[model samples]
Target: MLFPYLLKVSLLLGVLTLGYRWMVQFETYSKFNRLLLWLNVLAAWSLPLIPLPNWGPTRIQAEFHQSIPKIAQAAPAVKHKIAAYNPAPTVVSHQRLSSLNQKLKSLHVMQWLLVVYISGVLVLASHFFYQVGGLVWVLLRSPKEKSDRRVVFVRNLRSNSPYSFFQWIIVNPEKHQPGELQHIIAHETEHALQWHSLDLLLAELQRIVLWFNPFAWFHQKLVQANLEYLADRAVLDGGFERKQYQYSLLNAILCTTEVPLTTSFAQSLLKNRIKMMNKKPSHYLAWGKYALLLAVLYVSSAFVAPYTLTLVKLPPSILRPALKTLATNDKVNFKEVSSKILSLGPSKAESLIEELKKKTPETTKAIQPSRSKWVIKKNDALFWVISPLATLDDINEIRNEVKSFDAELNINSIEYDPLQSFIARITVHVNVKSGSSSTAKEGTDRYSPMKGESGYLTKSGSLGTGSVPNELEKQLQMDYEKALALSKKNEPYYFETRLMEKITALGSSSSHAFDKNTLNGAAAESAFRYDGVGKSTDNFLKLEPEHRNSELYLNSKPATFTELNSLSFDLVRSIKIIRDARGKKYMIVYTN
Candidate 1:
């Protein structure tokens, strides 16, 4: 799931980068464009974490709504009746067990992926620190001169010494002619005085974290290019000879070294800088473009993010081999499946039941924080979320508790044949101050990997958004549905939806799913880069970091990572990465 979240962030970078190229890349407003690029990066990283505004969409997919019609050859568990259910017997849910098994297996793959990602991060991080340490070492050993508030480090380097980091301007005065040295000192002084090194450092960190994202690399280049443009402009404005400065730039490039965290006097962006220097200044009025860009990004991000709505759900399909012995016509022992099971000791279970009940139509209210008018009224129906692992005794305790709390609680939500459900689930979704990749401002902290990739926890029961009063309900539903339709096109395809639901449709398939244990803060998602540690059976190889929007070959044929997920890894005989004379690598997977 973290993979999906990071994927969203990277995609945002791609989108915003394209937008910048089209709207502002060629613009001559250095300061405005600088701000624009910063916004682009910040928005891409933070938008996914922000909660949707109240006016944004609030479409609640019926957690238990029948998205697919009943499948052909309905399984027996689908018809088990409640009134005649027998107790003290096992009524195992094949779908539930299958889903659990998938999580257990995928956890291993997730761990391996974490290892790969951490390794990349460490390697890049070490290199970054080493460069920084080198700068410190050189500064300490070299003599320094103070000009105004800036410290200049005069070092003996044949090339690449004229660079600035923070307030420190480093130079090799012996290599440049008097005029050229003047231009170099002025240019690097602009970098130091303006604290341009901070920008480079920030960009470098982003590159390190998202080392695999091509856009991250490109964005860093954009940032450096702009800074150089500004610096060249400064040198010219300071009355330095433009021709001599241009000449000095060309000469300095001969000995330039690529230091990611410093702004050197000469850069590969030479052509772009010269062109920008000569280009007419963008009309001051052009500053308004940033305002327009921001408005558009905010509107798009708000509407584009999926609204997190809680609704009870059932598994709609079985993507893999299921357990044999399903609960057929066994009489569901009503006494065991209820709202309370105290024998497990004081637990979060009762509160979960209460949450589910409160989210029903009659009790539901507008999702606060959002605090909008989304309420469902007078819907007194039976709603329960049963745990698959509950024993027959647990069910009896729940039945007794429900009767004691309110004799008519399950009057409508509970369907008879639905009685013997292995999991009598009544989950409450508390709208806390957390945020996530999904919609809404509450719960699912973007940084909390333990909440699952979706950042959904104790989910199922809608919070506060019950029946909007009278006509308010109808209007809210109508407006929210429109927003929901648009979001469906963009929302990530969370593979776990299938596992979260036990009441599945016939013949449904799911992608690989992971357990919460493997997805932690420091790891999970985007860790698998070019073959991390993984498991391979004789038939198929379960690849981590698969589904990376790339193409691979299955037995010399084109196959998507998604298609590979449903494939049994036990059938994969080998996975090969091969290249032709062109050097374009192709992965060919052979199945046994």
Candidate 2:
């Protein structure tokens, strides 16, 4: 983020510099040049500082994907492949987690760079203020004399230098002959009347803030040179001899001593000043060159301007309807239910689910057979007898209604019970509120095949319904409970206690919770941004660019953590917690 901001600043600087160069090349009017330079300099420093809309160009949101795993069962004669999809855990030992946290606390190269840059700015700013104070002191000590009604000159100063400090023309009479003093007064007066001192002050402030930028120094020199050119033109325009003025300037270079906040009459770079005085005057057409400044500013504005995006999220409540629908079906398949819910989006799915839930009088109970199946049939081949008194035509209508709810339900056979007249052996299921109101009891034995020596027997000779012993079942239950507890302990949320406590203390809900000591970079970021908790950390990184820090490790190898979207969440396990030293709310994620 810092890099991008700096790059934009640099581009603005380049564009303005190019404009200045173009104006200088054509010898455009000095006053217009001064205006262009000042405007561009201020624009370059300030455009990036202006807070643009952060939501537009920089907003990032987590994507939602269906979590249900797909299952496809094949027939007996065909080969079948079953793959169970699970979110695998990443394990990090206790010792390594401690080491990672310690490593995270160490200062990075960018941090050191900021420290050094800030130190330079402080030093330069102090010196600029000191120079301003020195100019004030010189004004207090020097004797003031009225040269004319329009000019006020300060004479007999300890420093023999001639300079202007904000409407006051300060010069030593003893150092210059009467003729040379006349030219010097004229030069210094041009600086005072035109308010060149203010330009110098602005340049000084820019230097202090951008002390590390060589372009800033170059820009200051350009402004200073332009001021001198304007002053030289004034003296020449006042009818001073070019040769005599040139000699005075050359003579005063050695004795010239001016502070940052003042404009001096004589200084180095006499060649550029003399060259400008000798050059032919620029044409009226060249004045049109100032138009480029406007273009440059426009470009800079477009470059720094931000864009916006509205984040979208689906609520978890929408899944309840689909879950209920799956519960009512004989074959409970999560993959199909989840797909249906997601297809309708969160709000629509939720509304539809609610309507479906309202139609059902009570929750559907799971099937608990009195005796297990002797030979289990495929889920598609099996059917449940919801109504025994309904006719064939009624069965067909009911089947269509159930199929409308979920196309996966297949009803192929219908038969009448041999002993009970008008009783049917057909399976036709529909919603209770769909006008046809024959009710079936919950947990009824819908799948029962008679055991005989010669009928529907497997190759094993007898149809065997397997059962676990009572003690073995109890042991399996205990193992399952222990495994669940251990898995919970390893989740990213498990180690977020201390961080969450600190966040709560700050009285901010925007803070992200990550198990830095256990979860890896990708997993930590996912937890921080989209953990189904109250607040999300999606926009956290954009809040504070300089303080946004993350360290990622893939298979124990160090990796770059740029954006959360680019990361693979499954590979992350352990993360290191890092707190921002700056007093703002910022979080750092480290993953392994």
Candidate 3:
């Protein structure tokens, strides 16, 4: 609020100051102009003192000084530069660029904010004017007979009449003399004929908007005083003797009471009016003076020291979370993650993970696989990258190996059953692609020989080593090693123990069914998994921990596990035919 009010005041003051200097320079200065100058200065200075709608008077004052310096030494320097300008032919583009730069600097966000604030204040001021004017109108009504001719009544006391706008004559019948009624009637009639009501209303409204402006108030007072003086002169023009009219004026003031609508006609300021009436009228060179004033105002306002404000914009992704944390906790600190990533060297992947940690810590914690893999859940896509191992300990090591990259993973839904103190199902969506699409299928197909293509087995059955083509075997082995290395680095092998325990608990109750659909769906789900021999695995598990007859604790299934070893073997060979062309490839890995 203070910033806005100050903006308005500064703009108006800048205009008036320049106007005044111009008027003086042009030698068109007169007493009226001098009075106007003082009034404008008083008004401008008093603006800081007035209470603004949204801010205190003190705040408004402080903001004014902060936005605009009191002593504008820069104005002189700028004026000198403008005056001593030499146009260089070669630097026209540079000049244009400079102008654009200045314009951009001027139209700041803060300036717009100030504009909105002042506009509201202007609206409030207008309402105040209307309210006060309405009150005055209601207080000035008179109970008199309507007539075409306007009339004024001079009475010894004031009447609570509510006819402030129209012509009505009401006199103190108790104190009215024979001819005095006629005199008062004529004066009030003159006011009505001149439509002074509208003038008064306008003046009052202006006063309200510029309430802090002493000059504006003084201007209104002057206008009222002038109107009265003119009215008194009219009576003298009506063939009344000067001395007699003067006596009537004094007598009118002494006898007549102040009515709400009638401008005060009292002897209080009658001496001044009388003097003005007697003096010769002074001439004003209005055209020349007004033109000079206008020129000065425009020139001065244009050269006033402009304000510079700085604003920083945060990326939209970080905005909401940052604001929420700041609001809830009174502070938002992401320095730890940010500094860690900064120290590791700035990379797009590291920056994104760090940002996620800052926004959603809980979700971030659930997605951690390793320092190299990033789990990203955006919209419906859940993606995870398993990178090659840089160390042996990376295999099956899941606790804090990856700078806690869980922040990048989005948890869509969680279903918990408090009665059983267990989670029913955590529906996690993840995209798992090892190396590339071309290699992903081939790599997974390497284990297809162990369990065929049943869509439920974990490994492929073996094709006799001697029967296998040497080149194909080499490619399969290389792809296998790469996938295995990645799995070793990121897999949570311990997670199997916990998962097995939960499965056993559920199976013992018989309430949880081991349906084929559930098993197939669970097997198809991709996670960061590792084989016993320091390698990554992409096959899903079809576990029957309580198989009732099985000796094996768990049964693993490949993503493609529904075909016999022979058919699956043919399918794997066929898939490699166009693996690099298009479409998704599945890895069928089974390990017993």
Candidate 4:
């Protein structure tokens, strides 16, 4: 969240700085105009901080609405249909799944980057506060005498160049006569009187937060320069002779201070300050440049920075909830069977019927007073209640009665024995009478677990690959082949037990074991570092028992001891460990 705002603020500051640079080059504006420019720069930096109102009902919202499915809109009825088949699972598109995965990964990366960026901000802010503390210490301990109610004069300070910080003016009195020193005090007095310290503090704080933005540094310089110009103008207006002030400015030598908040009397860039003092006032038409600033802000608000953010409210997808129960009929009747097997007295039977009707009015409209098709054995406590309710409410009610034993009610939908009904069947009515001739044959199984060419399930029962897309299959196959090949080549083929023991004993530095000087150049340099041979750099050997590289291969392939060929130590004619010209080590076991 902060990152996005930082980016926007940086962009605004950069544009504002460019505009200020271009306009200031062509005009000698008054202090008021410069102040306006400074405030606009600050405002541009703060634009991203303002909260934007959500702009709902954009074109994107319309696209989102079109993309989601609506449950009320039923799938069109098929011309040629088959009944008593299980429903297939809905297929999710790969594009949708891929996008979701990418978003999750991006969220993780953003979280890590946010941590790093905030750490940098804290470090920069700490450094900034340290500078402020150093300046405050200097202000407190320096020798000072009261100049007036609003100002103080500091003497014997390390700052050779006269400067003002808040209410205190520091100058080395020994360097100038009383008349020249009074001029210096008046110039420093102007800065303190105007409260220029507040502006410098704001600029310094902005720099600490946006240390990475180059334009922030530029803005700070411009602000400080403008404040100096304002101070110079104020001094001249206070009755200082122009020629004498100009002579004093040229002869002044600056002793730089660490604190940027102070208004230094003899700062570098003296020439620009002198030119600003003598330059004629800008023409009234010069104010036209400000109109360009307004235009830039308008463009930014319209395209770059939106103040109004609309949020679109979309209907939830059909998949968000379970399939809604469709009402099959306006009313249904439940009839009690012959009171033989399960005779609840007439009172209890009537009460149970009333309870059922109250709980599920959509499924149970009335209880028939006549005998039902299902008959019960006399004296039995449970019996079937033939029902004309087939909606989802009826199904749920029947299930609840069985589980809770709510009342002595049984229906044909329930099976008495285990495994009696493992699969459920639904009966839906659809008219198969078409005016045109049909290709479907009579007495055909339309769902025989085979694929058909007509794109619809045929009498032979084929519906071509269901929903498995062809492109996805091809991509999966290609990836599977590559993985299979990689799996084979990455596995090493190890030699037999005795050869392995010999190789292990040989170690990474065989020359050290044999007290020989065969290892030279690159090999000699790495002789002591036996570990991390095959791990860090690929295609290298690590004969040391504790250290092994993952990329190290046995005869160009990774191998476990079990994968080695059976061989006896006596059958091995020679054992040689050699480092090739490229510094790759190879272990060879040759048979007689």
Candidate 5:
């Protein structure tokens, strides 16, 4: 999960970074470009927090950018752990044991990767703090000059290069030309006025967090580079001759020292600086390109954004995937028999119930509980949140309240039916502040109805009074199906329709389901938007110019261009475009 989050940060950085590199690199709008750079960093991290209508490209890479950005950015890989809740019974299958072993091994590897990443962060954080401490010491110990800016003369300082930290401008009078000293002060002052040090500090912190990512460092480079351009333009605009300022920059070039949190005057970005200074001013209309960047960002937000993701953690008993055939196992133990019976699946459970009827003639027919307490919802309204009230008339009186918050359904109905092998228990997972957990169904009258835990589930609605179930798709399966069958074609089932209208809320979600948002988010998207954002990888093949030159991939791995001919864009989760060293491009497609 941490991996995917950071990967999103990295991918977003790469995309906006490339957008800047590809569309507009050099122009005279240094101040505006500097702001864009700042915003790019903010957007990279924050965009992942905001969900859009849907996802955009899985990947948009530049040949020259760092490689790690593509890794987790577009690839949705997670380390999984097997059910460690209950120990395996005496007679476990060899294949099941092997799968558990593999998963445990992967969990261990993921733990180590996390440890290594944390260690890197700690080390870099210490270094970053040390740099900040050094700058702070110099600011405090050095002599101050009376000026509008907080100017500090670093007496007998080792590094001759003048730098600015927050509002303090550090310079040594002996190291500069008498006239050039003013220019240097002016340059450093620009940094102070604009609070450029804050940007460097943010970039440094991101570096500490994303130490393994080369693009993070490059992202910092861009931030610092843009700040320098901003300062250079400021100096030239304020009556300083361009030629004289260029000479001053060249003259100040010495054995420059690096300060992580401070903005230095003699930056080594000379070539780019010269190009930027001479570059023509861009037309105001060029701002339109930024809209394309916004659109691209909006697209990326759909997938990586924390769109209402919820984890439906069914009990491990139901998760065994019918590994062993019911008829094949001869020496089945009591626990194995119960697990097999419970895991028979929804459709198979119905058949198993029928078979039970012939075997036990004493069994009573299943009695339907009072419809009052039952959380019956129509099939089409699967995505809607229903009120907990008994009828539509009660919900209509408080329409405003029902529209905003999910009504908590205190479902306590239970019936004893010997013929009902499945109890049809509904346990909703929510975070109610005052509620206590109780067993959904005890082993009351054997026939072991599938066991599962019900936790509190609500979409930004706190149901302090009772358990609230947001998604009743799986739990209310039988009820929903029956309601659908009862309804007239193209008409709502009157009984359940009037029953669920008040509860239908949260059409789009951004819920956090414990530890598996990506899995849950993807599943929810697949369920709600049957056709998710069509990936653009295969679509690139339709372009004559691109098909002739670009490389292709399916699911992140290299593939021949011909594969795109058979590719179904409808099935794709996302599409990525990568450019290699020779300017050749890569089009990759991902499917669920």
Candidate 6:
């Protein structure tokens, strides 16, 4: 949110700064300068109201809902088990749980607050856009005659010259000036052709969206000045002399007629036009420099923007040294400290002393240190495994191979339920000894008879009946068949080799050493089935290839744990490899 807002501000500021520099260098003004200035101001004021989606709040909502199941499953199971054994736990343990609950509640409140803020900002932005749109529409519809022939006043003040939108021009046909009418027509035509009215309206709109930003106002001014420049170029291209053009511009500025929005000849700021006429065209290199400056400005704005507000709390132990250093400084007034200490009664003084002692170095050493280590007391540990087959029967041979390790290995659980029309997931839980557990990380190297020798080779292809036309369906079927054949020939071999490498690596890295002193009952709690993803059985089923065969899968395939194991050597080891800041790594082993 901050990034987008800053970008808008920088863009507006850059435009204004560049425009002012150009104006100073040119020593002249365009006909619509005053109107452009006013429009720019309006745009700046309305900028905050411009409608923009609040992606932050939306993302928070999604993440919260996704994590809810995991939290509910983990929290309740531990709470129940603890309560069953003892109605109330120690004060320390109870306090920790209470703190966790408070944190969760705070997170929920923050999520809602974000949602409300986003909603309000969006509503305000929409209203601002609507107001600007209305103003532009009214201006565009105003009554103005294009070419009026009256019987009265006809004065030839100057020759044909270019004028920006809403700039008034003096025309006299009675004097019979050469090409005077043609030049006037051409100048006005240029304004209409360039849609200068719409440009002004947009500039004004931008100003309103960023009214608080001075840069927004500047940007509008720059755009108006450019409009004038473009119009001048058009007039020059139409074969008007620079001297004659200057005279015409002067005459137009001298005329004091306010033209309607519908009228092409609307004279605005005459002084600025006179100044602009005397200036030379800008160089191309200036634009390149401006572009570079814009890039730097954007990067700086992004870097300086405030993002997260989560600050790490410094423990009192870390602050004690700093406090002691400050107290020792001669500049620190002893009188203030003496007065404050005297103000406290004997009882209060004792309480303060006690509080300080609790935060003191000796007290910190006596208190229990953070549990940063775990020990493998038992050889048996739980491990979650996923397989491509729907049932244990399909991988009975592979399971036997895994059990051949010297330690006792037990199958904790297995599931082969269809989640969707054709999709299904096969989840298996196994308990293995700490030493044997290392094999879980090793990539699978099993070769079944059903495995495709030619990888993902396909025998047939067809365009299933749907909304597609016959010709399009035929073309799609041909493409599908080609893809299937390629996959059949190449995919199986690639997956087999990759899986073998990963499994072997994991088996080699198995660790048996564990720190028993740091182990906590809470840390050993098992996560629920739906804790990670969700309780959407259909979603799980649809993810499997067997289930997907029933439907025309449109979305791209997601990489599963199996695929990740094959690709990343480090990831093949385990789901998590716990390590402390001191670089000591610990492997967790679960017992069923």
* Top candidate (lDDT): 5
The per-residue C-alpha lDDT of model 5 at residue 355 equals 46
Q: Per-residue CA lDDT of candidate 5, range 388-504, in tens?
A: 111343223322332323433333444322333233333322222222122244322322232322222233222211222323324444443443332222121122222223223
lDDT of 2: 0.52
After superposition, candidate 2 runs with Cα above 4 Å error: 1-7, 49-105, 108-110, 147-151, 308-592
- Candidate 3 CA-lDDT value: 0.38
Residue 53 lDDT, candidate 5, scale 0-100: 25
Q: How would you order the candidates by lDDT, starting with the best?
A: 5, 1, 2, 4, 3, 6
Q: Which candidate is the best by TM-score?
A: 1
**TM per model?**
0.49, 0.43, 0.31, 0.43, 0.48, 0.31
Alpha carbon lDDT of each predicted model: 0.53, 0.52, 0.38, 0.48, 0.54, 0.37
**Model 5 regions lying over 4 Å from their true place:** 53-107, 150-156, 307-592
lDDT of 2 by residue, 188-230 (tens): 8888888898888787777776677777787788888888888
Kindly list the per-residue Cα lDDT of model 1 for residues 10-117, writing each as its tens digit. 888877777676677768877767887888878888876555444442222111112222232254455656697667977668998989878777787778787788
Which stretches in model 6 have alpha-carbon errors above 4 Å? 1-181, 256-267, 282-288, 291-295, 298-592
lDDT of 6 by residue, 318-348 (tens): 2233234325465644334323432353234
Instruction: Single out the weakest 10-residue window by summed lDDT for candidate 5.
Output: 376-385
Candidate 3 per-residue C-alpha lDDT over 545-581 given as tens digits, one digit per residue, 9 for 90 to 100: 2222221211232222222121322112111000111
> Can you tell me which runs of candidate 4 are displaced by over 4 Å?
49-108, 254-258, 307-592
Model 5 clashes, total count? 22
